[model samples]
Structures are given as C-alpha cells and as structure tokens.
Target: MPAFVGAIKINDISGSAVVNIGDVFHIEPRSQTKTFAGAGSFNTGNYLRVKNGYSVTHTVDADNVDNSNIGNT
Candidate 1:
C-alpha cells in the first residue's frame, strides 16, 4: 500500500522507522564509466614503463573487470 511517500510522518511506528510505502523500484542503477587520454593503459599490470631515465621500475596490478559487471535492469 505504498506509492510515493514524502513527508507526512506518523509516530508510534517503532524500531528502525522505515516507511517506504512500496512501489519505488529503480533497480539496475549501476554506472561505471572510465575515459582516459594520453598515457595508454587502463586497469593494468606489468607496466614497467620508463621514459628518459637511467632507472629501473616494476609495476603490476591486474584485474581488469574479470567478470560479472552486474545484470538485470
């Protein structure tokens, strides 16, 4: 018995006070956007890149969205 509730609270509702009144379904609200420019490599591993230097560097951190990016909208 709930549609769109907004301010008109009643007391004596007890423990947790959550009156959602049902029918507020906004599922699949997941957003993950990534955009990069100049310096290639997004979500990487083993990228030991050194430009104009007499040095040694090592980098590795790989897990570029293995699986399951969430479904069902």
Candidate 2:
C-alpha cells in the first residue's frame, strides 16, 4: 500500500480568496483520455498533496474549491 500523507478540512460558506503555502487540497480529475493501451479512462482517484512551496499565489473561484484532510502521517 502507498503511504498516506496528510489531510485538511475547510468550511467556507462564502467569499473568494487566494491560496497560500501550507494549504492542503484534494485534487481530482474530471475527465481523462487514454493515450496508450491498457490505460483506463474515466477513472477517478483522490490524491492529497500539501503546498510545501509555490512560486506564485494561486487564486480560485467558489466553484474550484474544496476541503482538505490534514495531520495524517
């Protein structure tokens, strides 16, 4: 099994803002195309990654935001 990192949870009823470092996120692909054989399509995977560092600030709208899980080692 793969080692799990951390998780975070955010509860925002309203507001638009930017994301800074130390922010955790849950990213999922809406759709994917198979470019090679044996490669599956429309597969959904939930992966978590922390913003250890970033060159610039990341902005997002209300539609592109979600809660995260943290403190999981």
TM-score of each: 0.24, 0.18
Model 2, 1-73: lDDT tens digits are: 3445477566663333343345446544333332332223335678844344334433434563254434422
Q: What C-alpha lDDT do the candidate models reach, one value each?
A: 0.50, 0.42
Residue 12 Cα positional deviation in candidate 1, in Å, after optimal superposition: 31
> How much is 25 displaced in model 2, in angstroms?
2.5
Tens digit per residue, CA lDDT, model 1, 1-73: 5576566857676553445555865534234444433333334567666354343434443767734448732
Candidate 2: regions farther than 4 A off: 1-22, 37-73
Least well predicted 10-residue stretch by lDDT in candidate 2: 32-41
> Taking the candidates one at a time, how many backbone clashes does each contain?
1, 5
Clash pairs for candidate 1: 2-21
